[model samples]
Structure formats: C-alpha cells, structure tokens
Target: MSTIVRVAARGDGVAEDGRHAPFAAPGDTLTEAGEIIPGPHHQPPPCRHFPQCGGCQLQHLDDESYAAFVADRIATALAAQSIDAPLRPTALSPPRTRRRATLHAERGLVGFTAEGSHAIVDMRECHVLHPALFALVAPLRALLQRLRPKGRAELHLTLADQGVDLLIRGRLPDGLAAAEALTGFAQAHALARIAVDDGYGPETRWEPQPVAVTFAGTPVPLPPAAFLQATAEGEAALVAAVREAAEGAATIADLFAGLGTFALALPGRVYAGEGARDALLALKAAAALARRPVVTEHRDLFRRPLTTAELDRFDAIVLDPPRAGAREQVAQLAASKVARLAYVSCNPSSFARDTATLCEGGWRLDWVQPVGQFRWSTHVELAAALSR
Candidate 1:
C-alpha cells in the first residue's frame, strides 16, 4: 500500500483530505449546485507537503472549478479598489509558459525549489510548458548530472517559441567542449538557437546569437536574455489591441518599450524609450528593416523621466511598464493632456490604481482588455485605453 500523507491546506493550518500518490493520483470530483457527489472520488486526498510546496494550492479541485477560483481572485482584487470590469473568461495556456526559470542545484539534483522555501521540488514534468520540452528534459538532466563544479549556485532556463537558452552558474570542463555539447544538443533536438550563461562561472565566455521570432509578419531577432512575452499568441493579442488604439495617431511615445514590440508595429513616427541598451539596439535594427521611422532613447524612466517638453510633442502615448506598474510615470502623462493614452499593465491591482488616477485627471476610461500571458498563475496583463 502507498503510504498516504495528509498535507495542510493553504492558509489553514489543518490538513484537508488530499493524497499525495507517488506517481499518479485520483481525479478530483465536482459537485453541482445543491447536490452532493458522494463516494471515494469526492473524498479528496490530503497532501502532506502542501504547506511547504508553493507550487500549487488548488490541486484538490477539478480543472473547471480551479479556473473559477482563479477568476474570483482577480475579481476580488479589482473589486477592492471599487473598479468594476467584466470577469473575462480565463484562457488555458501551456503549463510552462515560463520562458525563464531559476533552479537550485544541490547534491547532483537540478529542479525547482518548493514554493515558499529554497528546497528543491525535484520536478519531473511541468504541465505549463510546451509539450516539446518534456522530451528534452531527460537530455537536460543527463547533461547536468555529468557536470560537477565547486560553489555551484543556480541554473536559469529561458525558453522562447524558437529555442532554449541556459544560464549555468558554475564552471564547465572546458569552454570549447561545453559549447560543442550545447550546439550538439540543439541540433539533436532541432532547436532554433542556444545560449550558455557562464557569467558567474570561472573563465567565463559570452557569445550570444539572436533568437529569431516572427511578430506582425516580420522576423524580429531577439537577444537570448531579452524580454519577450511568454506566449506568442498572447503577444499577438496585445499587439492588436495596441495598434487598434493607436491607429491614425500622429506622434506617439512608447514607455517601457522592450525591443519596440509596439513601436516597430505602429503606423507613424514613434519615439520609443527602454532601459535595456541591447533591447533598444535590436528594436532599432527591426525598425530599419521595416522602414518604420523610430527614434529610440535608452532611458530608465523610473530613475530619470520623460520631461514635460518631451510629452508636449506627442499626440498619443502608450505605456507598457514592468510588474511594478507605472503609477508615477502615468501620473506624469495624465498631467501632459495627451489626446489618447493606452496603458498596458501586467499587474491588475496596480493597473486599477493607475487607471483610476487617469480617470480623476479628466481622461475617460474606455476599456480594459485582459490578456492571459501567464496562463496558470494569478497574474493578468491588461491593455486599457483612456480618451480625453
């Protein structure tokens, strides 16, 4: 008999009925309104490790109910701020939309750490990633198993729609041999590109080739570590929303512009700003090829901002900031009286706060279109338009 252990429920100290079967478990049963679904299926197996593993908490619920729970979470967060928006249907994305993951390496084990702690989870399969990654996992594990380096830290895996890029934290046997091995792995798997990060390792060598990704009918080359949306479909949806909002606008300012995803696609003259030097250069290259007149400025808007004089020249503005949201910067734009402002935010709470600010500044809140970029998690990416 498999020894079943009871795990504590999330936020509740008491363990609920959920079992941790070694390889597989029972399917979660669901109940209709005012009806009780009886039997062993209804009796959930309690997880013994639930309190510790931060990976998942809703494992006991069926897939449909689990999705509703996720929607409720976002709705609750937004409701707190008195913002009412339609609860958009949750989009089911690949389990491993995680383009980049940081893993801990200890005692020859390479895997993700348990949710709240630094302890490894010993992950065999990630349900969220593209299915192709499952076949590549064994080879990745074999490669890591062969490597042993002193003072080893963590491994970072970045997967794009095109290829996989790795950032290993310790020294390898030899640079030439390691590069040859990575290239061989790529060819064997039919990968588009590969990047090895030995920046923290001894005798590091950095040689990166652009990862090719098609966007808006153009092949844009992105650096290995560059920021791209985890899901290509999600990015396309966002691009469509942005283009729709900015159509026929004269001069536009793109804030927090990474690789000019929106700037390169816009119809008119674009003034783009990004903190990353490499992203700006790549965006410039893409613009040149597309014959789009884009003047990019590499500026950290968080530290030094776009001046009022700079804001006065643009007829429309588009902002896509980091997860922190662009509260301070959005406030600046609200004061500028730009004709139409489109704000794209990954965090809904901050988006609500910032959008409220714009509303108070005489700009009308037009619509908030939600995009499921990170499919499984509580995160939401929204593109909202405000017209004065």
Candidate 2:
C-alpha cells in the first residue's frame, strides 16, 4: 500500500514514490490495485457537481485538511525560492460568500463549465455563490428561454452595493418582444442594473441608478465587468495586510491599482496608476467627491512600468497585480529606493518568481498572509510584506 503524503499543485494526490492518484486525500492509502481508500481527511463533497465542476478542486477534503492545503500552497511557493518568512495563519472564507462569478449559458442550459469539458452543468444548486446571485439563476434561465434564437451566451454576475449587476455577452435581448421581455425581467426582479454585449462592448439596457462597491469605508462606483475580489472575507484579509505594511508612510505609489482598492483606504497622499479607462475615471471622481488625496493615472504597466527613478520618490509601494504577476514592475522595484512594499497576488507560482527578484535585490520577506478566497478550490491568494 502507498500512503498519499501530499497534494500536487493541480490537486492530485502524490505518494512517496511520486505516483499520483486523483480524488485521494493527504492521509489516504492507495492499494496495489490502484484504489483510493478513504482517509480521515476525506469528506463527502457537499456539492453535487463536485468532481465534474471545474469551479472547485478540493471539496472532498475536511475543513482542517483544506486549510492545511491553502497554507502549504504559500509555504511551498516560498520554499521554492529558498526563502523563509514569518507567515501568518491563512484566512479561509465560508461557502456561499462569493460576491462575483461568471456562469456560462447555451441553448437552455445555464451554469459553470464541466471539468476539462465545454459541456454546461446547468446548475440546479450552487453552494459557492451568495444567495442573491444564485437567486437570479432561475429567472435568468427563464429570460434566456424567452429572448433568444437558442444561441450561446455568458452571464457575468456581481453583487454591488445597490444589488446584483448582470452583464450578458455574445448575445442580446434582440427584437421588440425580446426587449420587452428583458425590461420586464429586470423590473420584476428589481435588479440594480443589466446590460448586454454582442462582441463589440457592453451596452446598458437597464439601470435604476448607479452601481458601486464599498471598500475601506468608501463607496467606489462599479464599472461594468469591473474587477472584484471574489469574497468579502478575502478582500478584508488583503486590505488588512496592505494597511499594516503601509502604515506611517507619508507617500505611496499604488501600481496596477484597479479602481483604487488600496488607494481609497490608505492614509497620506496616494497615487494610483491603472490601465483601465473606466476604472481610472471612476477612482478619480470618487476621490475628488470625497475629498481624499488620491491621484489617478492611466498607464499600461506591461508596456511601460513605473521606472525605478520615478518609483524612488515614494515612501512605500503597493502592488496588486493580475495572475500573470508583475515581472517587469518587480524588476524595476528591485532597483528602487522604496523601503517598504506590499504585494497581493492570486498566483503562488508567479508570486514566488517575483519575490525571488525582490529578495535578490536585498529586500527581506517580512511576512505573508495566505487567503482562501475561493473556498474549497485549489486557487490561493496572498498578501505579503517586504522591506529593505
């Protein structure tokens, strides 16, 4: 018998001999016949779509085992670079807390894609979405049934300060009957806003007023399909880490700052550089209206990152980059005079690579806070602090 000692990066169980087993838990034992014997850490998945759903990869593990998995993801990433730091306990969000999600729709089917397949799950129940977002699913199914030529589309759902803001892509509420049906659907459900896109761009078909997201005690207008942290708990964890890292700094440069997630909350003079026009304008307007000292700039970091010479002027820096990570930007930061830095990332592999670059430049890894925002999934996020 081979005992499963750990989980691989993609959620498969690994034995001491490097043999891999799917759906096996950390303590599970594999028999010579290649069968998984249930272990103490293995729990019956709550979701009916568990093994088939691409949305999650670790639902079979118990709570303690799941938490360990999240923590190990960060620890392993750091160890890969031969770096060590005082890592705080990982924060895990509860199920049904997801504030934003993307669901697929085709013909009469609606839900997430199947694992490793394009076939739709047609969700009858979802344990990951906020109740409000899930509440729209049935009605959305009805609306799609009424207003379509039986074509494929996508549903982008986000719970805003006002209510659920929905965007449908690849199709629209076409024709007068379809348009009327859509208006009735939006009004009946009392949705905050609804829009459609036929590949060109999203066009607002209905809006009660404005949609916004409240972060760090401020209400920032929510742009269509704007980036948002998956869960409220996850956002709080990231923000607390960033605030602790940036405390006492008089001036801070927030790079890749999407809609001023940190700039709106941070103290002192803050400059935010974003690549999205709508998000940049929204952040600027919100800052001015609230009389906050946050300046916004529109620049593509991938094309031209903030130069080291320019980055040296700030007392501290904050980086919240996409999953691809900020290799170029981190390279520039490695040569700058900034004393403190906070990096929030959703990809552990990418984060490790960039942290190595910063560590090679004499910066020390102060601490890291792992967050399980997408609960029961292999995806991991973290907020880390570095100092000279």
Candidate 3:
C-alpha cells in the first residue's frame, strides 16, 4: 500500500519533506520535486553535496547566482540597522582564487576531507586552486606518500607567483630525510621555494618574496602572508573604491592596517597602526620603497584603544578591522574632529554593533557597498563610508 502524505505549506513554499515543490533539488538522485523554487536571489543548486562541504558553502550555485545570494545576505543584515543604501553587485571569478590550502596526509595518501566529514578524499584535482597548483596535486600527493614521514598529518600549502611553501605537521619518523624529500620535490617540480614546519620548536619565519599584482598601471608587491584581499579582482575594486572616497583628504589614519593596503594606496601622509610587528615592519619598508608617505605604529588597538586625542591627529580615517569590529575605536573616531571615516569589515554583526555606537556618538552612515571577495563562503566584505 502506498500512501502520500501532504504537509502544510507556507508562503516560503517549504514542505514537510524538507523539499520545495516548485524547485526540484539539484541532483538526479532525488525522486521527488522540491516545493520551494530557488528564487532569483536564492543560491542555486550545483554540487549534490550542499551545506555539507565546509570548504565551500555556496558551491550549490553558479558563480553569478552565488554572488547575488551573498549580496542579498549582506543587504538583509545592513537593512536591519536602517541602513538603506545601494549595493554594488559584483560577479565572482571562481575556480582559482584560493592561494593557500591545507590537505590531510594519511596513510600512503594525501587529500582534502570529504564534505561534512573528516574522512580524506584522495583528490587528484582541486577546483578551488589555481591551474598551476591544481595540476601539481597528483605529483605532490605522490611525493607525500613516498616520503611517509609522519602519522596522520596535514600539509599547509601556500602558492604565489614566485613559488610554493609546504608546512608539514604531526610526528615524522625521519626529520632530516623528510626535509631532503621536500627539497628534492621542490627542485623537480620547479617550485621556486619550499619550507617545512615540523612542529619543531618555535614557529619558523617564512619571509616569502613579494607577490606582484597590477593595479592602476602600477605593480603592487604584497607581502607573502600579509593581509591582501583573497581575490585579485576584489582587491582592485576595493582599492579603487577607497581611493575615490579619499582623493583629496589629507592626513589619514589607517587602523588595523595590515601591510598598509589602504594607507599606501592613499596620497599624502598616512599614519597606520597594526598589532603585528612583522606586518608593520614590512609595510613601512614597502611604503618607503614605493615612495608613499606612510608611518606605521605597532600598537594593540584591541586591548588599549586609541584615544580621541590620538584620533584628532587625522582629518580622515579608514578602518579595516578583523571579524571583531573596532567598537570602541569607532566611537572614539566619531567623537573626534575627523570629518569622514571609511570602514571596511568582513563581519556584519560586529559592524552593526560598532555602527550603532558610532551613530550615537554623532557619526552618520552615508552609504555601504558589499564586496563579494570570498565568493563561495557566507562571508562578505563591506565598505561603508560615514561622515559627521
């Protein structure tokens, strides 16, 4: 006996079967049609493995569709705070934006974990990596299997235009031999450089050569591990947006400035502050080389925040804080004599909190635009321009 049970439907069209009737689920494995059609703004179905793969949450849709989904999510978050501004919709350039990735090295095999599981998938090719590095996956995996020095370890691999870096983890049976194998692999593969972090003592310092990217007919050399936007196109757009907003502003303060991405791009003298000594040193030197006027100060803005007195030194400010927004600093900047403040943030929740504080402190939200830098993930970078 076959009995079909019908569940109550809402305006959203979601049914009890957890499927939408109008929109069929993406794969051929599904026997029933989904009740909810993927909306114009909804993420499309691409991979059968959706929400499971921690690697890419938005892989279910094509690049353009995915970018819209991300933009809408950012819009919804911002609108909750009464911020009604035009969103700059952008397309995602998929299939090669990932510069660094960590792979699990198992018994005689090396690969990434399967969707939703730590179980390693012995992958011959990764769709997320650049073609040059993607083509080397098999050979690199074979090299790991032959070396077989550690037990259930992970390989941290970073690729740039200059070379590749290999940071090995876990216990290795042979230390020196493992190093030799890695060195040999690099030489044979024409990998410009190779490094090993065998959990040996302190963290090894890897000063990678500058990676070159063209912007406005100028070649920008970014430090290897410094904070550059994930995608090349995204960085260009973000830099242009900031430059346009800050064209004639004199004396800018770049808070949470990692390698002076905004500070160096801006004209006139800029004061930059970051918590990391290495990043600040590299940024200061690079600024000098580029003939850009940027003075960097290594200070922990989190623990001890910048005072209003310090904020008064700059006529304008740009803040690119981490996931945790610069709450206190935003309030301080709002109270200071600074006329305009541009905030670039990745986390909307933190941005909302900080925006509320700033608004109360006398700053008005002028506009916000979403930057779809990290294409496949739920994370969206936002650039907000505020004024007094």
TM-score to true structure, per model: 0.77, 0.98, 0.80
Q: How many residue pairs clash in each candidate?
A: 16, 0, 8
Candidate 2's clash total is 0
Name the regions of candidate 3 deviating beyond 4 angstroms: 1-52, 108-116, 173-175, 200-226
lDDT of 2 by residue, 224-323 (tens): 7899999998998999999999999999999988888899889999999989899989888889989999988999998899999989999999999899
Q: Can you list the residue pairs that collide in candidate 2?
A: none
Best of the two (1, 3) by lDDT? 3
Candidate achieving the largest TM-score? 2
- Candidate 3 structure quality by residue, lDDT tens digits, 109-130: 6666765588777665455665
Q: Flag the better candidate by lDDT, 1 or 2.
A: 2
Ranking by TM-score: 2, 3, 1
Best by lDDT: 2
Residue 375's lDDT in candidate 3 = 52
- lDDT (tens digit, per residue) of candidate 1 on 1-388: 2222221212111112333322121232222232223223222424454424444444344445444544555565567777665644554444455555556666565565676677876656564554554456567667766655555546655565466655566555666776677667667776655545556422213333456555555566667556777676677767877887787898999999887778877878899999988778888787788777888899999887786667878988889998788877877877875778777777777777777777677777666566655543445676767788
